[model samples]
Target: MIIFGTSSSTIHPAKLDGGCCPFCKTKNQMWIQGYRKYFHVFWIPFFPLWKKIYSVCSHCKGVFEKKEFKDQELTTSFEYFENNKIKIPWYHFTGIILVLLLIMLISILPFLTK
Candidate 1:
């Protein structure tokens, strides 16, 4: 049986003072974070897929998504973090590495047989 699945983890975390939380109306309490999803085989991440941007209000425990960011300051901070901080980790390519090793072995087997 082949074990394959998807998983997500927090890749970035930062405090945003750009806008007040819509729910709590509190400034400097919103946290910007990034979550990355990856495909995995047997619990080992194989490759990365989509990234999700989220903000949470610590004062009221409210959550927001990328589309919900309305304030210009909030949006700017989010874009900067996404563009500069978020990156696919190296471990996510385990599947590709395994496949390449398998291919190499197969190629070498033919030479060894002769």
Candidate 2:
């Protein structure tokens, strides 16, 4: 049996300077957290699939998805996260890198003999 599935990790959270939470009407209390989702085998990440961002209202302790955020400032803040928080960790491609090295070594081994 092969163990494979998907998992997500939280990216650095970003704070909105002038945004207000639609739920609590709190200004500058809204923050967004990004999750990097990837397919994994035996807990080793293969490659990233997609990213999801959610908003948290610090005052009200409410967590909401992109569709739930109706405030304009929060909407633009979500866009900022979608565009900027996409730094892929090197470990996410460990399987690919290992496979590539193996292929290269296999191809070069025969050439090196006699």
Candidate 3:
């Protein structure tokens, strides 16, 4: 999920422009690690999984948590069409085809041996 706001000096700006904080405006990149909580017993063994968030800033040197960064709206106004355009690359399709062919060959080989 993404959030966007603009910087303003008034009590409340309808939108946020871009707040300037020492760390928010820094020019550095770092990884922020967070934890994922499991609420059910189905995931008892891996109760907590570490999640890594990649981030880059222009002003701060240390890593910032997800809450620290202000969200920005993507201003792209393009209409998306729902045509049957292949999103995956050709190599990915080839890889999947190869895996399926190998599995089929393996199954047939066992039948032939009997």
lDDT of each: 0.82, 0.82, 0.32
List model 1 lDDT by residue over 14-111, tens digit each: 88757778666787788888688999989988899998888888899889986786677777776777787777888889889989999999989988
What TM-score, computed on C-alpha atoms, does each candidate reach? 0.78, 0.85, 0.28
Q: Which parts of model 2 are misplaced by more than 4 Å?
A: none
lDDT of 2 by residue, 1-114 (tens): 889999988887778666788888888898888778988988888888887778888899899887887788878877876677657878889778888999999999998995
* Cα lDDT over the full model 3: 0.32
Pairs of residues at least 3 apart in sequence or in different chains that clash in candidate 1: none
lDDT of 3 by residue, 13-61 (tens): 0221233333655322332222222222222221222323323333464
In angstroms, give how far residue 43 of model 2 lies from its true place. Answer: 2.2
Candidate 1 residues lying further than 4 Å off, grouped into runs, are: 102-114
Whose TM-score is higher: candidate 1's or candidate 2's? 2
Name the lDDT value of residue 110 in candidate 1.
85
Instruction: Mark the 10 consecutive residues where model 1 has the least summed lDDT.
Output: 16-25
